[model samples]
Target: MDEGWDTVEVPARGSDFLQLAVADVPAGGKAEWLAGRLRQAIADGRLAVGSRLPPTRVLAAELRVSRGVVTEAYRRLAEDGQVAGRRRGGTVVVAVPFTTTPPPVPDGGSGEGGVPGTGGPGGRGAQGGNEAGGAGSVRDAGSMGAAGSADVAGGLGWPGDPGDLTGPSPRERVGGPGGPYVGQGAGGPGRPYAGRRVDRPAVPRAGQGTPRPPGPYPGQGAAEDGQPYAGEGGGPGGLFGGEPGVEVFDALRAAPAAVDFTPGRPDLTTFPRAAWLRAERTVLAELSAGQLGYGDPRGAPRLRRAVADWLARVRGVRVEPDAVLIVAGTAQALTLLHPVLRADGVDAVAVEEPGSLGARQHLRNGGLATPPVPVDEEGVRVDALRATGARAVLLTPAHQFPTGVVTSGERRRELLEWARDGGLILEDDYDAEHRYDRPPVPALRALLADRVCYLGSVSKLLAPALRIGWLVAPARYRAALVDAKRFNDLGNAVLPQLVLARLMESGELERHLRLVRGRHRRRRDAMIAALAGHLPGARVHGAAAGLHLTVTYASEVPDTEFAAAALAHGVKCQPLSWHRQSPGPPGLVLGYAATPPGVIAEGVALLGRALRELT
Candidate 1:
């Protein structure tokens, strides 16, 4: 009898979730009956290892039985080493017991009265005579209800009773007209035995019977076109053919070389990772929900204010926070400026002759013609710039690209006068913070604020991955630039802007600048020194400032051919002619900021050897 039978009632729900069940057991054997079911489930693969058996209370509720019934059943399985109760992680099936084999019978009936083998004709007579003399002994071993009868039956050819085997054993018995225990006739869902349990049918699931729609047959109906597709190379349905074009930096990025000395890269290893992480944590903790949402197209208010303060402190440019337009580096600034300039009847802008090829391409792509203006030791010559009859001239007055010359005071005054006469000046204050031998020069924007559109970025100061820069234009074009930014990705990402603002306000950016400037100065010196020793005839220009030095060779060798030969010798550099729209003497623009001093020496030495071989 099970304990607590009066205290609990069996649950009406069937087993589904955990596959637990209980039923009324036969008289005198309910505990053992339930234990055998669990053991059989474990022996076969139905109940996997580490599977958690339900708690006694839960299993009792699901099976409509007393909790003690489930507990006693689990205890019997535990006693057989088939299951173990784990605290909290629950009761788990552990191992199963193997069935034992019966002992072999002695030859020639040695354990019984002596008799001839049963295969002979007198065997039955001999067996009956021994049984008659030993009736009690035969009854003790051979009777079904006697002790040791199961051991003897195991040796005989009789299969064990299905009830004594496992639940649902290897066969099933279905009810016939006789009774619930009667076996059905012939073949059906049940097996050919009586008094055996049947397996529970698998429950039908909700979505299992639904069929999926078939896919389209192959080579049918124009290949199931989703949209009107177009082939490559500019058709009416092509991606770019239906709209205005966009440019990509594909060619320059694809070229391979041993040493790349292309300009516009900073020392990435000097990025202030610790300071950035600190800023990020602070921003995340303090930022408001509205701040993380789409920000003002102009920029975040904090970063704009910080940028305005920074420009006033470093570049000597005064501005309201509203005047600063945060952009995706200077590239976006140029793109935005392009339309405004074009609408102002500015068909052509004058560029320095040996200037940035990328900048020239950017302007040309925006439907503006680029007229070449000569750059001398004093930067872009205002006299020559005026001769081009162009209303706009782009100048790098702080540190000219390639040549690295500062625009002199006389030329600044001359250029300011030219701008005052209604000529627009695009001032690229690039690499102005980096100078070894001279004091800082005032930006051209400060001298003539109304006429100059100033551009600056952290690409040189920190890393290009930041992609954060700013532009301050005259009031005339401010609204147009903001609209362009609004349409282009709905302004820059807000989180990086917040982190950058924290860095700027905390004075960490200035500390990083001081460290890199010292390293770059040493590298620039190594290149200059190596050039002096190896190529005595080469005239080095722009050695006082910037990340690179320009060396002009007096020898009669083509600049492009010289660059190719240098690349063959495992050194990469750009020919000055690549940046020039007008003819000039042969030279190479070599960057040294990212390379170490030793590598700089080796690269310059290779260049010298390549020059010798080419000349």
Candidate 2:
């Protein structure tokens, strides 16, 4: 005989219920029922080994059962070595099901990411092939870019067809051997401020001369490197504080303020200097004499493997190493795709309104148009995206930039549907690892790798100065993107890639993320408290996770003016207006990761004072 049944109610937000449509389990045997369902899920491959189960409390509350019911159910799985608690990691599956054969990973499956590089079927490649590896190997080794913004958007593919790779590369296409390029890397093309970088050297391959030593690169010690933006008296960014234009990204970074609340920065003060130093030393000690010369354009195999494995463990992305194309940064990843998209007849990329202006600029730099789509509570409005008529769109779904809205499941399904109908997705998962509150969200690439191009970088967790990032593109674009990388600065400095690989493999990067998540959380709490006390009207968004928070208030004042006022009052930030091409609310993207509690409070107080003075 069964007891009275409990009403089945499951919360949608942050749920790990496996979306089972579980209406009712036998009331008397709820735990048993739950365990049985989970056991079958694992056995049949619906639940994978790295998949994380909901926290006992979270599951219990969602199921309208006592926490013990969930606990007991988990315990049953534990007894069978199916799932186990992972402390702060929550509970995760540990063993594969006893099936006749391994279960195929269905698309749009569990968002709970498993351990990276660990679960792929043993012999399969990231794209299940080998041509990508061969393409990545065609590098000019040791080719380095000069410190010039004008040449930053190095001509990827020549003026010929974007798809025509067999034709001359930028080097050959522009001018046969060592054409007229100066102050350039292999085949560098110039952008806005091109004339000023002429003093830098041209780095043709060994055929030109010994590979030029790495100096005068973008971040290196060039006359204009530190002063990214030069205004009256030469500030860190520039003197202009209001909604900055696309051209001033480097200058905005260079601008200085007392209490910088600028978002997207991880606590650089707490970077594991010692750990990095140790890793670099180890890399040097273990390096073969041949390795110090030039290296692979696909990035270090060790790093690619490390990244693939890491993604598998954490992001739930199923890829073999060869599929990974290492680049200077996500910035370069976007640039590399310019020709690829153009070749595919995509001249415009739909962007989320209130999206990263830098991304918009990069796309434009690639000679593509950026159409804006509105982002609501769910995410970039798919309806709006569809209306944009752009075949491709870029997203930061895990934790959207500035806005911080995770794309809801319904929206995700819509995105997949759109992709199936010929649309493309470029996923920039820049800060996915720094999540503090929610459990891991499975990457979209995990669901539809064939239609998505993924970008990730170490600039946040490690240091941006390292200038390292990776790209996982669909097979259609992989070879072209690799060629772009090869010609665009010769595949990032090899030594740093190897060092980062060591860190990822040795668990240093994960440890760093954990340390920073706690610190960033404390700072985030401080900012929220400060906002409540000082700016009563400011409604904070995207506070659930990420290194920053976006706050909106009902103010007629242009957010750019508000930002300028804040900067005048010894604080710095970006106005929400800067990210949105269309008019939106007056808000600020406040970064908390680098600021300490006391400093954050001081900055917010100053912001309040600045706003008061404005009105």
Candidate 3:
């Protein structure tokens, strides 16, 4: 791990933020050098007690060091009890190691004198404004929200002062109480500098903000004119009642709720920031000048090959690297494919009665009709597909969205036979990788390659903001799909493709998957138990797999009314009717992945309260 610091260049790269240079060290191991400098700074009151350290990735990038080196240095500091990771909050100083004397600050030092409201020398914290700890040596977390502070400055003799792991943590000193401190753990993958408690107050995470009056947000419910808003009667409009529209999704997002259960989002707190930075750094460090120009329309070869290999190993889908097409997520995949399908004389794509509304919209936007096909317990009723008379069908076969039913083996064969009858299959294997209770179901594309256009994305596993996905089309449509992608955006940004390819190949992504599966499983169990206790007659669906579970109850009340009522009781979720083209039974899709088990139970209880009041 030693980078031969002995021969390292003088006046080595320094960060204006940290104001620490690699040249400041005594010329040895990179991690040791950085750790020693930070330790000395903390001990000397230069990196004062509560002033936060710069995020690992930010500092590493500025200093031109590998992310691993910075992580290693942070790990050592954590071991010495000098710092600890806060969930949703970055690593911060938990204790200052014993020092012999207070060292004088040099002429120019970025590490010295900055604490929130302290006006030390810098008059600002490391992150600036009030994000840093209290007046001088500790932050009054009350002002910052949720994450109350530990007054380490008051007593250096606190129970867990650095080296004593058996003692209570600093969080307990401020009233959080004794519990496991999983820094970089499954409970939540602590990103370096995830921010100080509130990512932003406007968002209002599960437990972050102060208690709100239990009711629908101001913008929701019947208007002042009061004509049942959208004729659904006495419930939230836009997203929660009547017909849902694309613009309503944004309104649903901006609306306030104490606990949110919107389906299809992963536990974003578990994102592997360190792994991503490592891959990104390596890709950039070795990138070629030629690779800097616009990339191949079908996506970079590196990512395509990685996807190919990854699919073969994980999903039982064998693919040649040349046949793979990188995309900007499943949305783009649908966007590019619709026109190609239209060009191929396919005018309508049949979707499951309870399917992804978003995908249906994309197909409709491309001037393709979306006919409805009913889905039974077995899966999308293939018999119904022939009734619709549509030549193409989009299916979430591996794990059906909102419903979580894996296509039965018989259903798969039926679909394969259907595909062979000159019908095209559009497979969205989005949640296939996150199954907990069942074995992997081979993608429909794997069974009948020529007849199926496969689509997959990391939106459910990684962050959706990445907007990266993969597609595989049969030989006939490959060129046309590539053309569509080329004209769409000249392919996704090449740098992210290379970085994602790096994550896929390095096995880090799989490791991340394993950690999150365990976390999600626990949360799912919590939701299940909460449903049983809170809602007596509720029936849970899709419990065997996927990020969300659907709950249907025997009642005449519309699901949207239940959803609007749930919002009034401090929970947010999607009404099952939103995904249906033809109405049937009422249900609510509840996502368990995005919340911890305790919060999941609370949110479900809130939903139950809302539902009970309605029914």
Candidate 4:
């Protein structure tokens, strides 16, 4: 009888059993029954080579059997060389059944070498030997059991089983260059065997599923250069094409490149996790019950005051806290201003010709006409803006984006005069705080507050994920902007606003700014050095400060085509043409802040190689 049969009872909950019919096993054979089932599972491939069996104690509890019963059964499998016990990895299957044909029998009768532990030569009866002793024969017979079917070596593709590859496997169809996993054919390295244990494949680890090919180009399935080719004519697929209103931001975000140099991205790796956590805790500890309610749409009172103080000290712009309104970012500031500007009978806004494409898209999306004005070394040509007849203009004065040209004193006076004469200046001091060699430039808003609606955000100073920014609108439009913000998402989440206020007032943000400046300066220097060595002919721009720099080249090929070629060579960056409405020299907008100096060098070197190949 089974040793534990008297003491252990099957729980009334269920009668769970393995492949073996324990109930049919003759009285004392339960342990032997379990062992027989396990051996068959391993041989027939129900359990793969690396698959772990349940722990002894857990399996014992589940089967309502004594722990010793499961342990003994596991021991039997181990002795047969079918499984092995790893310290913490549990018991794992190690070998498959000896399905391949065995060595031919000796000329004389089979003797000592009778498949170790089996009934010597006689137990090989199925292969021609006679039965020696019934007891030992029965023992050998029980060991092989259902697993013996695998020894026959034929058809039947069981789940998790590595079936006989006698015929073409399904993997053969999706194997070579024609398939997604390009360059790998059936039975080739890194290819999975059909219906086999996934863990056995040399490719990506078990549960990750089929790995996606690098870069998702538009219409094409996969590309050799790892860049997703959307369609012919260099247009991205799926709603991104040569259409005038094509969404560039969405398309670029959808197809992320391996070595990206997309501009305006900050070094997110340096965000102060410890400091933010401490501030968060401090804010929560001092937070009152009343403060949890819907906050002031203009922003939390604490943050507004902090913004006013910080701006006065750093930006040289003085304003009462009441004039400041917290927003999602400069993006939201534009969103809220759209309605306010429209109410003031403004239907069109003039943007710099080679300006931010994303900004232009947002303005157009808000139902405003954006006329392009030419930008020269002095910044947006005041003469060009007057000709366009756009009463309102959006300009990045502190650090002109894409091309970092500061507004000259002559240009500033001209803009102030234009603003005084009923023109609205929407100043985006986007990345002014990151200046390296340039002296601080007072914001256009500081000169003419009533005409210029200034926007600033923590996106470059801190992390964009925070979605925190401050907008100081002219007094006349402040209330209207606040109302627009209130109706759009009931103001930014309150707790983060509070935490940010702590960082700003406590000087933590300034310290962080200092830290990233040094890191960015080094990276900038590295990129400049790399560009000099690799892309000697390429003209680099805006290297003094900011997260990105522009490189213009006097090449025969169009900038967009060149960008596509670079992407094919495992590099990603935006073509300057993407940002400009009016034509100019072809260039690429490359960002270095987020990438380490080493990666920046490698990426630029690749660009040089790709450029040379194209030429």
Q: Global lDDT of each model?
A: 0.58, 0.63, 0.63, 0.61
Question: Which regions of candidate 3 deviate over 4 angstroms?
Answer: 1-235
What are the per-residue Cα lDDT tens digits for candidate 1 across 221-251? 1223332211123211132111111221232
Residue ranges of candidate 4 with Cα displaced over 4 Å: 1-246
How many clashes in candidate 1? 3
Report the C-alpha lDDT of model 3 over 119-144, residue by residue, as the tens digit.
12332222111111111122221122
- Report the lDDT tens digits of candidate 4 across residue range 129-212: 111110001111112221111111121122222221111222212122232221121333333211221111123333222233
* Better candidate by TM-score, 1 or 3: 3
- Per-residue error for 92 in candidate 3, Å, reads 39
Look at candidate 4 and give me any clashing residue pairs.
1-28, 216-228, 217-228, 217-229, 218-229, 218-230, 219-230
Better of 1 and 4 by lDDT: 4
Q: Give one digit per residue, the lDDT tens place, for model 2 in 318-375.
A: 6768889988788888988988888888876778766897897677667666666666
Candidate 2 has what TM-score?
A: 0.67
TM-scores, each model vs. reference: 0.59, 0.67, 0.63, 0.62
Q: Which one wins on TM-score?
A: 2
Candidate 4 has a TM-score of: 0.62
Name the regions of candidate 2 deviating beyond 4 angstroms: 1-243
Comparing candidate 3 with candidate 4, which one achieves the higher TM-score? 3
User: Which 10-residue span in candidate 4 carries the lowest summed lDDT?
Assistant: 129-138
Q: What clash count does candidate 2 reach?
A: 14
